[model samples]
Target chain A: MAILDVRDLNKSFGGLQAVKDVGFRVTAGSIKALIGPNGAGKTTLFNLISGVLSPDSGTILFGEMPVQGMKPHQIAEKGIARTFQHIRLFPKMTAIENIMIGRHTHSRAGFISGMLSLPGTWKEESRIRNRSREIMEFLGISSLAESESTSLAYGQQRIVELGRALACEPKLLLLDEPAAGLNMKETAEMADLITKVRDLGITVLLVEHDMSLVMNISDEVIVLSYGEKIADDVPLAIQKNAEVIRVYLGEADA
Target chain B: MTRNRHLQVFLLIAVIIATQLATMLTDTQHYLTQLTMSGYYALVIIGLCLLIGYAGQISLGHAGFFAIGGYTSAFLTTYDLSPVRDKAFIVLLSRMGLLVSTEDLYGGQVLHLHPWAAFLIAIICTIIIAYAVGGPVLKLKGHYLAMATLGFGTIVYKVVLGTEGLGAADGISDVPGFTLLPGSEVSGKLSQRITNYYIAWGLVIFGMVLLLNLVHSRVGRALRSIHGAEDAANAMGINTGRYKLNMFVISAVFAAIGGVFLTHYNGGIGPSEASIMKSVRYVAIVAVGGMANLWGALVMGSVLNFLSLRGYFGSYDDAVFGVILIIIMLFTPEGLLRRDLFSDIREVFGTGKDRGERA
Candidate 1:
């Protein structure tokens, strides 16, 4: 069964239709990649699914529940977490601290308990800290734990963001252009990481422009162009789809 | 990290204890009273630090909450309207040993509510008012939030100045001092300068401990996340709007508590207490201390307030504060303590390279 389902989603900013009649589905525990040219509204669709922007008219379902119209935090609480296309780590915080914030939903300690330094609050806090460190270790960035997030290298920052989203313990993860700016080696590592994430039983839905990375790691690829889905198929079929090829080549020609 | 926090906690306790001993050894009532006033300011400033430092929400009208607290206690303890005097609630309170009968200047019998009861009532009222105001006001970002708080402060100041029953521009006077134990033969008014000093500083210590613990907790991380990036914080399953409003209300409560105790200590509250200038002065203190640094705010708030009370700036208090604010913003916008100004000086002297390598 699909973990995420978007049906006939529509969104516009002013008169420019950013996402129009967009729809897709990601089966539970599968790796899905969304690939499109610059103006394809892939990020817009990601935003819609993550509840950053509401659709003008559509339904978003995470499992059996409708997620459209829910706030971003509400959607996150419903077991969906996302990383930004642009890195958005808390600049002044340590990398580990940034990831621990992702554990916010799972932790139950609140203002009063925190202020009093209750035993339970401390226990939960230590648990979160330990878990966050474990995540950093898994990402192979444990050495960067104490470093300021903004001071890290671009690839390291991307890994930190991924670690942060993973700390949410989401059933479904959305990665928005996770390898937008990286060398070939970094992109290869990111692809390996995405595969590792999917192997952990979390459904992965990612939007990327790098066709090589998408075709290599994605079990299914959804292609979008000019705010509409142009092709939805396996990576091999998407590579041969005439319309998807035309959109990419047309952008290259122009 | 745990060891560092423990050390900090130890240092904080030591500082509070040393301050207490110093006041006792000096035995100067006037200086003790001045320090006590600084303590009140410290309570409000510490709350402002949490609001500005962690939540990154600016409030320029905290003095309005302070005024509300002062006037609430002042009016309740001093004024005896005919309706309120005869109310069943008042009679019940008197029966319960919470209110006492006292003779007014006109030889009329008036029911005087216990100062402790009045203080609690003032805190409750301030919280309610803060909730109502913070809900909408906290939504505004940047200068808009500042402007809204400033307008709220001005409105409160105008209302206090125009209300006849509240003593108009002269403000309410003769607010009663609180007794620790009511309806007891040993209970006496907490009117001594030394007693007031300890009470004020003791509250400050409590506030500091609470704030320090909060900053190290889960909620504190959420607040810092919000400050770092509200959109990202919301995306991380944090209710950003709710947290912002909560901080705003909490900061207001702190200010109100300060106002209540200070009013009782001074025996009066004036319209100037609610002035916009006073609110700006608080924001200035927070900025001067360092935004997002709790201990820095406490130290700077108390020290600056103490200096001001000593008449060092005299009539130029506002002007001096403004200049300090401008200088801080221009030179070290991060905050005084947060910026390593000494390192920058060393760099200017061309010795920073060697020092940096050694470190």
Candidate 2:
């Protein structure tokens, strides 16, 4: 079953149509890659799915329920979480604290209980702390838990950002340019991590500039050019498609 | 952290007692009046610190909330109901024991709300105003947020200065004392000066404890996340807007409570209390305290307010605050008391041990 379905999605930025007539579906627990060159509306699509921008006209169904035009936090509560194309960690906080923020949806202790220092609030706090640690350990960054997030290395900061998203216990995880600034080794490890995340029952959706990373692990691939999708198929077919070669690979070669 | 926080509070309690004892031993009991007033102003400072530091929002209208509380209670308690005492609503309120009967200087019968009823009404009114103002004002960011709140403070100042029934520029005076117990009333009477000092500082300590607890909890973590990155926090399922709005209201309530008690303590409140300069002074204190440090805000709030209230800055009070605000903004927008600055200072003094420890 598709966990998310975007139907006839359309978005315009004044005179510029950023995304047009786009439709796609991601099956449960599968890794889907959204690949396109710059200005192909990949980030725009991610924003629409994450509710950063409402569609001009479209229906976004998550888990078969309409979620278009809802607030970002509301979409997240419905079990969709996404990281940024650029790193956006809470610079002043520790890595573990950054992850525990993801558990905000899971923890319900409010300002009153927190101020009163109620027993339930304490219990929930400890649980969130321990769970955040577990997520860091899962990402192999347990040793960096106490360091401030921004002070960490660039690759590790990316991992920390992914850990923050994972802490939300998302059903559908969106990764935008997860390997953009990484070296080859870090990119490979990120691909491994993405696979690990999918194996843990998450449905992974990603927009990546690195073709090798996309072709290495994606179960299915979707290609876009100038705000319109050009292909949707398995990795081998996407690599061999003539239309993709003309608009994507041909541009890359030049 | 828990033990350290309690230790800080205990230290504050010791300081409160020591200051009172020192004042009495030196025959300088008059200082208690300024100290008491300083405690109330510090209440407003710490609340502003929470909004500016944690919630990542700026509000210049807190003085408006303060004036709302002061003026509401002052108006309700001073407005005589004798002319309409026979009305069903007045009689009902009288029967409900919400009305107080006293005598003016001419010995005529006067009827009005008891201080307790007026105080409750004042707080409720502050909450209502805060929610209404905060909902729209918090949606703005950066300098726009500052401008909106400044406008709010100015409007309150104008309304209070021009309203005929609110005593205009003369403000409300001869307000009745708030009798919390048999002898412990919130008033400026010299006999009760020491009691009022403890009352005011005790409330400050209570507020500090509550705020400390809040900043260390899940809600506190969420607030920092919003401050650090609002859009990222929202994508992670944190309701940034609701948190910002609620924080605005909470801080406004703190300011209002300070206004209510301080008005009763001083036996009146003036339009100047709601002035934009007062609001700017508060923001200046919060900036000096370090944007996100509650403890720093408390200490700075207390010392600065005391100095100003005691006339240390003389006629240049607002100018002094304005200069401090400009300097902080120009050189240390992150605030003056951050941990890194302390570490740097220690290094300069050759007392550093944890150099490069943040790494």
Q: Tens digit of lDDT per residue, candidate 1, span A51-140?
A: 888999999989999999899999989999999999999978999999999999999888889888899998898899999999988888
The positional error of residue A41 in candidate 2, measured at the CA in angstroms, is 0.6
Q: Which residue pairs show collisions in model 1? A: B53-B292
- Write model 2 residue lDDT over B1-359, tens digit each, in one string: 89999999999999999999999999999999999999999899998899998888998888999999999999999999999999999999999999999999999999999999999999899888988988888889999999999999999999999999999999999988999999899999989999999999999999999999999999999999999899999999988988998888889989998999999999999999999999999999999999899988899999999999999999999999999999777556667787778655566468545533522
Native contacts retained per candidate?
0.85, 0.87
Measured over all alpha carbons after superposition, the RMSD of each candidate to the real structure, in angstroms, is: 3.6, 3.0
Candidate 2 chain B: worst-modelled 10 consecutive residues by lDDT? B350-359
- Deviating ranges (above 4 Å) for candidate 2: A251-254, B342-359
lDDT of every predicted structure (CA atoms): 0.87, 0.93
Q: Relative to the unseen true structure, what is the C-alpha lDDT of residue B312 in candidate 2, on a scale of 0 to 100?
A: 95
lDDT of 1 by residue, B106-156 (tens): 998776777777889999998899999999988899999999999999999
Give interface RMSD for all predictions.
0.6, 0.5
